[model samples]
Target: MKEIVAVLGPGSWGTALSMVLDENQHEVRLWGVDSKQIAEINTEHTNKNYLPETQLSDGIVGYTDLEKAITGATYILFVVPTKAIRSVAKQVAALLDGKTKPVLIHASKGLEQETHKRISVIIEEEISSDLHDGLVVLSGPSHAEEVAKKDITTITAASGTDEIAKKVQKLFINHYFRVYTNSDVIGVELGAALKNIIAVGAGALHGLGYGDNAKAALMTRGLAEISRLGVAFGADPLTFIGLSGVGDLIVTGTSIHSRNWRAGNLLGKKVPLAEVLESMGMVVEGVQTTKAAYELAQQKGIEMPITEAIYRVLYEDADIDEVIRDLMMRDRKAE
Candidate 1:
């Protein structure tokens, strides 16, 4: 009933997950690239930079050395940013070197910018199959700030194999945290990655001072856009209506805690993209994800007008007002 888990990344999400594992009575080896953060977690039991005002459990130990962190660990949860997934996974491959086969689970959401591959796909590409059990993705509307404070949250653990999904479900389920399993890995991953784009749009609408009516329209149509692209990529349409799709879109788009939404809010306020990102002090995944989704939509011949509009404003020098006007002036169609 006990598992030794290696959590790669010591950010808010990673620390919050470590707390969940500690609550579930698992020995968590929390790994981080920052030596100061690791020392703080080890000595003070606090990750102040990320999760302020929270004390971590003694069952969770911090490790700076990647090799030392994962040694003899049964489960490796990759909670790093989307961009860091590949490099960290490569490190896992070089260090593990056929020593132990642990179940690989990733909580990071987003597709690689150029390749447009899901986080799970990128991990599988970097880490050999022999080094771990089949992959599982954990995702939903859950936010690190809420989860860190013991708020009730539900998320989906998806894998190609139901057995693997169930294994992950049991590992994180507890009083405040609930985990559900889904077999649609493609749908789940796409929903997880693509929702951030929609969230950015929602934040932009908010920043522009649009009220409930406009926000409702954006979220509704955003789901339509997400569903269209997701179906083209062979994902189940039903998955979009579920937690990882609509659920994640709702929370991330509306919550101030969401970096993607915050970034979009700043952009809507006419703040420069570079300044917004620099001020956030965190990875605004939606910014990069919008580019990837725009490219993917073009490649797949899927029409995603909202994503296109956001992409233009972020990547191109297009004005947000002009982009919104162009979106409204598009050819009329039945919804």
Candidate 2:
């Protein structure tokens, strides 16, 4: 089945997914905002800025022009960062043909900074109501680098429409990369964003020389907070117990590959947050997402102590020991 697929973003995850789709025998066009990166991948078939060492698929064509990429796209996979999701969504909307319907698969995580909306929400606002039902959010524990290596990874393809979900599943699922269908859009999106905050918490603990016990405790309690906020946002609680929730938590919290966790690790090691991020050359979503989550919690009256602690540490320059003390001294409650 040769389907035309356009992936919007030239970052590691976008490139890796494009490679996967290419291997699956789909014609893929990789699009990005960065002209140099698009030119590099288009000419050399490699993302030197992101995934430097991995080999890209020959069938994958890279394009910086959004119009060129989305011209004949049947299924569009959005792989851009969360902060840029809306801007890219608007670009996509402008270039979208009113006649040719495309199933939108949102592969990015994190809530919108401006409207506090999810990527799927932004897409729904841009595309026609007819296409709104086709918006899908794809997420899991898979990391971009490992997926680029052809490692076995399982992910979820969630949408309001089962027909669209099936289409996405057929297009993306492979022997090494398995894509399952999920109906819980809020759960999947929330799980993806919330995991980064917990990953930062876990990474901070690791940087502070805490063992697995502390990390596990953070993960469990973090999921509780995640569930609380998610339920407030209309997500099914059980969805948090699935791959996008617990699975993503385990992977991001434990893996050194996670940029959010890595950033927190540096912060724990006594480096300034700005300095750490500047050195990484990549976006550590947790930093921005923490501020967003903190605001949401305050507005919704949600209790997220761990997130607050990280927020204070980042914003107020709170003493780490005192921050830990505040978390530990909280009134005990049932689990």
Candidate 3:
């Protein structure tokens, strides 16, 4: 059955996902804050700034009006940055004041800075449960550029309930795009968010002229700390080995398409954090996530050396080389 889906955020990932829904024969309304971009998407059938090479589908419409974009949609996919999730959810909740609830699915990955809350927790806190059926997280190693070109990609749709996760699985699954359902929402989300931090470290290693052996070692040890902190926060350790975990870490850490990796790469070349952010012109989620994770680890008394090292590089202006030296000098321990 065809459904009306609202994809909020006109970024590359959101635009790519809108294309996916269009491929599934659903009516997609892509909502964004920029009216010019929205008009371009509606009239020109392209989002040059984001998906410059791909042509958008006719079935997908762009909207700047938040209420109109979501008014009658049966599903809402929030693809905005983590920082914007709360405000967007509040707006959606207000728009759905007395209307039927829609299924809420988010693809953003990050932990809230000060509060250290997950994306779903932020959304749930702002939007009353009455206005939404359930919260689901769609995550994996899939990249927007590859997905836009119809590349084979697999991801996970996780919710507290199997029924909700399966519902999302059906909504997105297709030949080139495979969707798996997982009941470990906490694990899935943590794996999705935490892997980006490791990716930054991976990119930094590359930027510093590190060879395959060093990169391999970094990834192996990075996953260890990620799983350690994740387990401390009540996430299943096995999820880290799955798509949202090791899978995401591999792609995000290695792929040039990843904004976080790119940012770290620039940092490795001795670029300032502000300069890197300005040059990229997109959110580098791992930077903020590193800070949040470091804080969370300290608060929870969890040992996460890689996360702490990245935090020092990003926040404390520590020299990347010195940080690497300190990391290497740490006492040896069993894997």
Candidate 4:
């Protein structure tokens, strides 16, 4: 069934997802704050600054007005950064009609910096239940750059309710983009957010001229750390092995397309955090996620050495080399 999908953000990921909706024959209303980018999307059918070298589908209309983009939409997809999710959700809630309840789906992956709340939680808190159908989290190993080019990408659309998850799956499932459904929203959201922290560590390993063996160790240990913290939060342990878990960890940790990985690579070279962020010209979510995860792990009494090492380096101004050394020198324990 054709539906009006309002994609909020208009960043690379949002635009790429919009392309998928366009291919599915849906009316895509892409909303963003930047007038120039919105105008470019409307007129030139391109968003070079974000998704460079990729031409967007002409059918994907861009809108600067929040109300105009989502007034009649059946689904509202939030792709904004973690920091902006609450603010954006509030804005959407204010403009949405009381009688209209669109299915709320978020592709953004990260816990809120201040509250350490998942994207879905923040959205639900901001948007009244009467104003939306249900909340679903769409996440996996898919990158915006690859998805923009129609590369074969598989992901998970997860919701507490199976029906809601399946609804999202049907809309995005097609050639080159496969969508799977999962009932574990907690696991899905955690895996999606926690992997970014490890990706930064993996990139740092590469930046430090470490061999594949070192990266493998870091990622392996990183997964265990992620799973430990996740389970503490009441997430299904099995979900950590699925697409949003180890799969997402691999892609984000290894791919150059990951902003977190790129940021980590720069950090590994001993570059200052502020300068690295300024140079990237994009949100390095892991930088903020690391702090939240670190604090959360501590609060939960979860043993997450890798997360702690990255946290120390990111937040405490610790030497990367010394942190790595301390991590390696920790007492032996069962694998």
Candidate 5:
């Protein structure tokens, strides 16, 4: 059963996922803002800037025209940055007017800054119910770099209904790529977003010459905070131990392929956030997520020490060393 799939955003993750669909024998339309990049992808079968040294399948086509990309697609995969989700969804919603509704699937992971809405909520707010059939999220420890090379990877496809989740699971699951279905959308999304904050802390510890023992401790404690905040927001605590939770936290925190980890590594070396952003030339989602999470925690009266410390480093220009010392000096408590 071949279908048309529209994947928005030409970042590494989006491009890699497009390849997966292509391999699955589906028609894939990859949409990007830059005409030049689209041209490069279509003409050269490669996205040099994002997935360097990887060749995209010829079955995948790149499009700059939003309407043309999704006009007749049966599935829409949103992979843009969290900050851009709302604007992009609005455009897609307009394009979807008077057309058959498509299954809406998003792989982006982050919460809205001030509003603190999950990605699905943001999309639902902008896109009319008449124009979309369902909302599903794909998340896990999978990295684009590895997935591009056909390395083994597993992820979760979560939606309100089992039918929707299973639809996505079927489209993506194949040899070397496994998909699991879950009904806990809130937990899955939170696990995907919150883990990046911890990953930043993990990278900072590494940049500051911390050993595996310290990194392990940071990740363990980070999961606890993530679960606490997630539970406060109606997410299942058990989801934290699953792929989207601990699984995502482990890879994002430790892998050099993670943009968030790389950003934190630079910050650990005392690099300015602006400079780090300029150098990376990609979205460091964790930086913004830290602010949103910190605000949300304060508003909800949830105690998240690591998130608070990372927020101070990112927003308040607090010294990383001093923040670390303060975190260490906090009164001891049972785990």
Candidate 6:
């Protein structure tokens, strides 16, 4: 069945997602804030800024106007970063006929820096939750590059509503992409957001000349820290052990293609945060996610040593060498 899918954002991830849906035979309207990118997608079907040679489909209509993108979109794939999610949602809210709009499927992974709010909370605030015909999270270990190439990608479509999650699971699961249905929305989201924080640590470890053993150790420890925080936030403890949790952690923490990992690598190489961000050319959710996670950990009194260490490395200008030394010599406690 062909569905009307609107992809908001034109970054690598967004363009990749839009291309996937278009190949799935859905009418995809890929909206971009970058005028040049939009022009390229419209005329040349290429967004070189993110995807260098991947040409989009005729079914994928690239537009700049908010109204033009959401006019009749049945399901919106919100692919913007955590910071831009709310603002973009607000713009969509103003342009949408709230009484009849598409199911807003958040494809982002991170808590908002300002309120530590999830993407769904922002949607509820921007548009009434009661009016949310469907609210779902699409996340996993899959990267935009792999998905764009039609590689076998597996992700979860989690929602409170069983029917909606199943409906969503069907739309995304194709020959190359597989979607699993899960009801643990909180766990799924928490896992997705938390992985990026740890990926930075992994990248930093790599930057410090750490090998696979170090990456594995950081990934496992990061999972524990994230699972602890997720359980504190009322998420299913087991979800942290599942696809959205450990699966995503392994992928992002190890992959150089991961923006968060690359950013951390840059930081480890003595590049300033500002310079690293500017060079990345796209929003690294982990940068802002670190702030939110630090806030959450502080508020909940959760002892997230890794998260705190990363926070300090990012914001407080704490030397990575000093931080690693402290982590290695921390107060001894049972694992």
Worst 10 residues of 4 by lDDT: 92-101
Model 6, which residues run further than 4 Å from truth?
Answer: none
Q: Work out the TM-score per prediction.
A: 0.98, 0.97, 0.99, 0.99, 0.99, 0.97
Query: Which parts of model 3 have CA positions greater than 4 angstroms off?
Result: none
Query: Which 10 residues in a row give candidate 3 its minimum summed lDDT?
Result: 93-102
lDDT for position 90 in model 6: 81
Indicate whether candidate 1 or candidate 6 has the larger lDDT.
Answer: 1
Better of 5 and 6 by lDDT: 5
CA lDDT for candidate 3: 0.92
Tell me the TM-score of model 3.
0.99
Tens-place lDDT per residue, model 5, 153-208, is 99999999899999999999999899999999999999999999998999899888
What does the lDDT read for residue 225 in candidate 3?
88
What residue runs in model 5 are displaced by over 4 Å at the alpha carbon? none
TM-score of model 2 (CA atoms): 0.97
For candidate 1, give the lDDT of residue 62: 95
Alpha carbon lDDT of residue 222, candidate 2? 94
Residue 262 of candidate 3: its Cα lDDT?
A: 93
* Candidate 2 local lDDT, 151-208, one digit each (tens): 9999999998888898899998998999999999999999999889989888889899
Model 6 C-alpha lDDT per residue in residues 56-133, reported as the tens digit of each score: 787778889878888878888898888888888888777776666578898899998778988877877887664457
Residue 306 shift from truth in candidate 1, angstroms: 0.3
lDDT of candidate 5? 0.94
C-alpha lDDT (0 to 100) for residue 80 of candidate 6 = 87
